[model samples]
Target chain A: MRIVVLTGGIGGARFLRGVRAYAAADGAAVTAVVNVGDDAIMHGLRICPDLDSVLYTLGGGADPERGWGRAGESWTVADELAAYGAEPQWFSLGDRDLATHLVRTTMLNAGYPLSAVAAALSRRWKPGVDLLPATDQRLETHVVVEDGDGQRAIHFQEWWVRHRAQLAARRFVFVGADQAEPAPGVCEALAAADVVLIAPSNPVVSIAPVLAVPGLREAVVAGPAPVVGVSPIIDGTPVRGMADKCLAAVGAQCSAAGVGALYGARSAGGLLDAWLVDEVDADAAVPGVAVHPVPLWMTDDDATEAMVRAALRAAQSR
Target chain B: MRIVVLTGGIGGARFLRGVRAYAAADGAAVTAVVNVGDDAIMHGLRICPDLDSVLYTLGGGADPERGWGRAGESWTVADELAAYGAEPQWFSLGDRDLATHLVRTTMLNAGYPLSAVAAALSRRWKPGVDLLPATDQRLETHVVVEDGDGQRAIHFQEWWVRHRAQLAARRFVFVGADQAEPAPGVCEALAAADVVLIAPSNPVVSIAPVLAVPGLREAVVAGPAPVVGVSPIIDGTPVRGMADKCLAAVGAQCSAAGVGALYGARSAGGLLDAWLVDEVDADAAVPGVAVHPVPLWMTDDDATEAMVRAALRAAQSR
Candidate 1:
């Protein structure tokens, strides 16, 4: 079986662990079309937060406790940067994490596209799944929020990390989505996939920005594969991260049914053919889409693999 | 009194400590025209090794034992970079040190000249002396060496750090020096100085590259101030660093008198009006320049201050 997973950072990375576990047992090929919307330049280093999370998590180097960055990471660089009084002090980049950014930035500046850089970096991580960025071009997710200074667009990192997503977000904007093309293998992966699974990542900011790429949404909707999504929300709340705030910004109810309906039936001008919600949301309903309730908490690899199996079953049924 | 010093990394930084101490007692203003020859980009970071050495040393952040970088610096970034198999692994940049480079590279990329960037960085260090780059433009000291690949020029850092300066070097090339102008305050500092002291730094790569800047050499040689040089070589050997290898590359003897004569006399269209050698080289002779022997080893701040006092005496005599 060939599987293509659309993913974001931390939560998606955890979900990928399950996917990898299931794929390993099933002898299935997996390709991850990772969202690059959270990528930003900090202290002159190009940092792809989502890509690094997946790389570190899958490569067995991620800080399991923190769910982001390298295990045993040091904050020497961040502290020193703060000492220098460089602006944007809110986002703390760990010393070990900064190395990945440095290498990525150097490669990107040397004319290599983001996809090639991700591939080069993966050589060290040996991330089991083929990880390709959603787009090689710039595609930052900007959050329009009402601050004391009025509504202003801020980078997704600043909005999420610095502000803790507390600011009343007006909407989310994918800055360069109109011009972005899918990374080298993205379209092909979608076309050749036996099934496509949407990770339990933030639907608004994470999956939305990936789909924002001009033709990316079209590729998945028109591709010859069954599309299934694992709901990031369970019991009207996000299992991890501030998906509630993101969903609220778009005026969507913070529930599995809301997200399911958001990524409506592909036959009805939407993306998903099936939606897998947590067992707690067994009563959730989405018009024109198959909704299945399954135990979705990714407590461990085995638990996550079970969720992946559930997602595969939904795809097969569809 | 207004004193101007031209210097490089490590040894020069230590020497500046003495200069600062002496200037404090004498209530004299000091300006440092630091060598940019040792500056290079590593992992896309603009690293000004000589400037940083002076900054960290004066700021009391330098590793006294290691003679470079932050005293309590960590190697997280270096280890991570190595794991990624990034190129130019020979020069290991400490985590704290990488922060300095990030700030500098960011500022430079934002269109700030190096002098301004150094000045901005100095706000934190408050390195007693006015620090200035020898030139604002690219002025890398490249060593011409013959290897299996035939005669080729490589960055001085690569030659020193990677090969350990073991390669047979033909000469040193001050790349981009011909078109390089003195950084913002360099020429002005020299013109208005009461005296100019050449710190006991590498004559071939350090002090030579400073002079290579267009009109900077002329300004120093023709300026009204008496120029006195402290010999990096003591007892026929460099007190520290690979000055001997550099001098050998330039076909000069590795001795106090040899260096003094290499600088020659201001009246003879060369540089120094006087030279200071170690007492061990009391017999050292420079035909057209006055040579004074004193303690050259910078054992401590007090010892360095004593040497600075001796250099001032030489300047007074001239």
Candidate 2:
């Protein structure tokens, strides 16, 4: 069986751990098309936060408590950069994490596309699932916001990490999405999959940017396979991260029903055939979309695996 | 009085520390025309060993025990790179040192020249002497050698750090020197200098590459100021590094007398007005150049300061 996933952020990475575990037992192959909107060139190093989050989590190098970056990470390089007073002090560039950037940046500078560089880095992490970037071209997520300075467009990282997303964002802009081509194998995987799962990542930024790649959303909605999106919201709050702020930016309510409405329904020319909400949000409804209430909290691998199973069942039933 | 010096490598860096110390007391200005020939792009970083050496040494951050890099350096980045199995593993890219590279590479990518980048770094380091690159252009020192892989010209870094200069070098090529211009302020510094001194660095790869720039040698040789050189060799042995191997490549004897002969006399259309040898090499001689024997070991700052004093005296006497 082939299962394709659209994923990004730490929560999505954690969810993939369960997907990978389920595949191990059922002998299913998994392909993850990760978001690249969060990628940026800082200090001449091409940094891929979403890609690294997945790689680290799946490769058993992720910090369990922090849910991001390498376990037992040191900040020697970061401290030195700080000492040198290098600008953009917000990004927590750990030493172990910086190694991945060094290698990736080196490879990209040597003429390889982002997909090729991701593949090369995956060789070291052995993330098991076939991992691909959403787009090889630069597709940055820029947040247009009115801060104390004035209304301006800032990179997603500056808004999310530096400013803590406090300033109300007017909207999110996928800078290069109009010209971006889906990375190789993204369309093929969607076409060949028995089911497509959107991991419980931030919808407005993580999953939206991945879908922003030209023709990517169309490929998912038009493909023959069933598409299911697992809600990141539970009890009117995000499982983690500032998904509420992102939802506010997009004029969406911070609730399971609201998120289900955002993805909409494939029958109504949207992305999902089935939407999996938390059991508590069982009554949540989206027009023309089949909504299933499942135990959505991924408290542990077993719990997450159970959630993945519920989504798969939802796909089959749809 | 303005003092201009042509220098490179670890020895030159140490020599500059003494020069800095001397200047602090004498209230004399010091301008260093540092060699860029030893510079190379490694793992996408513009690595300038000599420039960094001088910065770290004069900034009170150099490892006194090891004679290079940060005093309390950690190899976290390097170890992680090894874990990923990144190629060209010979360089010890310390975490603290890698910070410098990131800032430099970023600035350079943003179109700042090496000289500008160096000056910016010096602001943080407060390296007392005014530092200038030999040339703004990419003047790389490549070693043409016959190894097990057959005859080929490899980067100076690969030849020096990887092979330990054990490979018999046919010659050293200063690639880009012919097309290069001396960095801004280098010619001005040399032309206005009251005296010029050549630091006791590797003649083949270090000092030679600095002189390789068009019209730079003319600025020193034909300028009004007298030029004095200190011998890197004492009793037929180099103070540090593989200068003997480099000397052998260029077919110059590894002796104080031989080095003086290589620099020759300004009267005979060569560089040196006088040469300083260690007290032990009293009999060392070069026909056209006056050679003086003095204490030459840089055991500490005071000893190194004494050497600077001797060189200054020689410049005055000439």
Candidate 3:
């Protein structure tokens, strides 16, 4: 069987671990269409936070304690950059992490597309799943917010990392989405998939921006396979990150049922055939969509595989 | 009084320390016209080895044992880059040093001239001497050598760092020197100089590239300031680095007198008004140039100051 997953960074990376474990047992092939909206250039280094998180996590190089970046990462570059007083000192690029950016930036500047660069980097990581960026072109998520003065759009990193998502965001804008095309193998993976699973990642900034890539949303809704989403929210709270703040920006409720209804039913011109939620939200409901409630805490690989099994079952039930 | 010095990397950096100490005691201002020939872009970073050497050395951050890079440096970036199988692995960039390059590359890409970038960086280092790149343009030293098949020119960094200057070099090419102009402060500093000292750096790749800038050599020769060069060779051997190999490339003898004569006399369309050599080469002769015998070993700041004192006395005598 072929399984295609739509994912973001950390949260989605943890979920992919489960998918990989399940696929290993089932002898199935997995392909991840990772979100690239979090990518940005800092200090002339192109940083793909989502892509790197997935690569490091799946390749067994990620820091389990930090939930992002490499294990035993050093901050020599970050500390030195700060000493030089280079602006945007808020986001720290660790020395180990900086190497990936250096190689990626050098290759990208030399005229390689993001997809090609991703492939080249993965050769070293050996990430189990075939990883592909949602789009090779620039498509960053910018948050529109009113801060001190007036409403203006800022890059998602500035909103999330620099401001701590404190400013009440009016909406999220997917910059360059209109012109972006799906990266190589993305559309093909979606078309050939036995099931399409939307990982438990921040929907507004992560899954939403991936869908905003022109024909990507259309492709998922019209494809011949079932699309199932695992809710990033449980008991009206995000498992991690500020998914609640992102949901509020889009006027979506911070609940399993709310996010389920947001994705809506693929049958009703939306992106989901089924929505998997935690057993705590078993009573939650989304009209015209199948809801599967199960234990969703991915405390370990075994626990996560159970969640993946529930997702696959929900896809089949639809 | 203002003293101007033309220099290269490590050896020049050490020599500048002595000049700084001597100038501090004499209450004189020093301007350094640093060579840009050793500068190159590696892994998308604009690495200015000569500029950084002087900055770190004068700023008291250079590794005394290594004779290069920052003291107490870490190699996380280098190790990670090696893991990714990045090319040109022979030249290692320390993590602390990489930060300097990032800031420089970013500013350079953002349209700031390298001279402006150096001044900005100096704000952090506070290198006592007024530092100026020989030229703000892309004037790199490339060595012509036969690699198995035919003769071709490779960057000086590759020849020095990667190959250890083992290849028999035929000649040195100062790429972009013909069209290059002196950096903003270089000509002004030289014009106002009371005296000029050529540091005991490699004459071919180091000092030569600085003079290759159009009209710069003319400025030093025709200006009222006397120019004195310290011999890189002592007892027919260079104090440090491969000055002998480089001297051979241009078919010059590896002796104090040979190098002194190579600079000739400022009145004879060449560089020096006086040449300072070690006591071992007290009888070393340059027909048109005055030669002074002195101890040239820079064991410490005091010893280096003595060498600088000798250079200043030579300048005064002429």
Clashes of each: 0, 0, 0
**Candidate 3 chain B worst ten-residue window by lDDT:** B215-224
Cα DockQ of the candidate 3 complex? 0.96
| Tens-place lDDT digits, model 1, residues B194-217 | 999999999998999999999999
User: Which digits, one per residue and each the tens of the lDDT, describe model 3 over residues A1-318?
Assistant: 999999997999999999999999999899999999999998888999999999999898999999989999989899999999998899999999999999999999999999999899899988889999999999999999997899999999999999999989999999999899999899999899999999999999989989999888888988888999999999999999999999998889999999998999887888999999999999989988998999989899899999999999988888
> What's the TM-score of candidate 1 when only chain A is evaluated?
0.99
* Model 1 chain B: ten consecutive residues of lowest lDDT: B264-273
The local distance difference test score of model 3 is 0.93
In candidate 1, which residue ranges exceed 4 Å CA deviation? Answer: none
Q: What's the lDDT for all of these models? A: 0.93, 0.92, 0.93
- Tens digits of lDDT, candidate 1, A1-318: 999999997999999999999999999999999999999989888889999999999999999998889999889999999999998899999998999999999999999999999899999998899999999999999999997899899999999999899999999999988899999989999999999999999999889989999899999999999999999998998999999999999989999999998889998999889999999999999988899999999999999999999999999999
On the 0 to 100 scale, the lDDT of residue A223 in model 3 is 87
Rank ordering of all candidates by DockQ, starting from the highest? 3, 1, 2
DockQ of each: 0.95, 0.83, 0.96
Docking class of 1: high
Candidate 2 Cα errors over 4 Å, as ranges = none
User: Per-candidate interface C-alpha RMSD?
Assistant: 0.5, 0.9, 0.4
